[model samples]
Target: MTTAIIKPQWSPLTIALMVMGFIIFWPLGLAVLGYILWGEKFGGSPEKAQAYWNKGKAWCSSNAPRHHRNHWNRSSGMSSSGNAAFDDYRAEQLKRLDEERARLDAEIDAFHEYMANLNKAKDREEFDRFMNERRGSRQGYDQNKPDNGDNNNGWGSNNA
Candidate 1:
């Protein structure tokens, strides 16, 4: 017959801490702090950790609060409105990114068409004319140059 040894009976730290805590603060301290810490080090699963934490929570809720109940309520669970807001912001950012991607795609398509048109250009004169047309007509300079003379009223005088 093969005996499959369970983990709890073999942990040395649990025994030591349990002894120390038992000697110092008796059952309450051993169960509360020492056992929990030991269990955290050597315990199997998240459920056990939660159990330890739940024990502490139950103690605190019952003993600490005078009247208020810590039962499941609308506002009892962990709030993630901040995260939800962040998610909304993230969605908006993704939407903006999609819009930008579409715009860039359109621009790329237009650029490819322009390049194709340039390649099909008849001659050097046609290419030069096309470049000049794409550059657009330059704005005519203002012929009326302003005379730099002190002709304004004395608005800078101290009128206080």
Candidate 2:
């Protein structure tokens, strides 16, 4: 029997290496820890290592988040779940949900448009009120000025 160089066991040398790896870079430390944990599966022939890799890949895919799994399923089209009635029900429900989402999106757009129009009207009203008040103040000031007939056009003459 051939003995492997680095046996997968907790030794002082391995621990020290792992610690050093961490001090150098974090991913290096993580890689060292993974080797310490699962290096036995990779020490054999290529076929054994490939089999272990495939197993780990399968485990990761199976444990992936629901949204990611659903995205894969959607890209591949609907797969049969072994029962026709259940499949039909699921398809119908998905279609209904999609239609409802579209309707809600349209409603949201309409609401944003209405709010924009309302804001514009409010701004116009405020601007009109400000203009009217400014005109009124200017007319009151013109009425209050005494009519000096020298025709200086509101500028006092040098004949003071």
Candidate 3:
């Protein structure tokens, strides 16, 4: 029988190292803290756990029926529940649902496109109106400006 070398596993030196690790590097501190808190789960021999897990997985895999395994392996969406009429009806229903989904997706895409076009047209109209207003105001200012000829002081100055 092999005796354990470390007595009183949570030694003061280990706690100090953990605290120092935390002060120096936060991740190291967190790792040390986790090891301190849940240290028991990591120990008690890894070979025993692996052996038990392998046995359980083998039992589960062996117990499953070949038909169920084949059904799972196949990528076909169709599954026969031992009734031909029901299978036919189920397949028809799935096909109809798929068609309806495709039609709905198309309609959604068309609606989005229509909304985008409507927004674009509205923006263009607003921009055109703004440009027209700017041009008209500039023309009005030019027309109201005083003539630069002689005796035209621009504030209605009478030279008489």
lDDT of 3 at 34: 70
What is the C-alpha lDDT profile of model 3 across 13-99, one tens digit per residue?
668878898999999978777766655554546775576668889998999999888778643755568889988998888889999
Give the clashing pairs for model 1: none
Report the alpha-carbon TM-score of model 3 versus the true structure.
Answer: 0.47
Clashing pairs in 3: none
TM-score of 2: 0.50
Ranking by lDDT: 2, 3, 1
Per residue, candidate 2 scores C-alpha lDDT tens digits across 67-132 of 889878965798877799999998999999999999999999999999999999999999999999
| Residue pairs with backbone atoms closer than 3 Å in model 2 (clashes) | none
Tell me how candidate 3 scores on lDDT: 0.78
lDDT of each: 0.62, 0.87, 0.78
lDDT of 1 by residue, 31-56 (tens): 74544446435365677778877888
Each candidate's clash count: 0, 0, 0
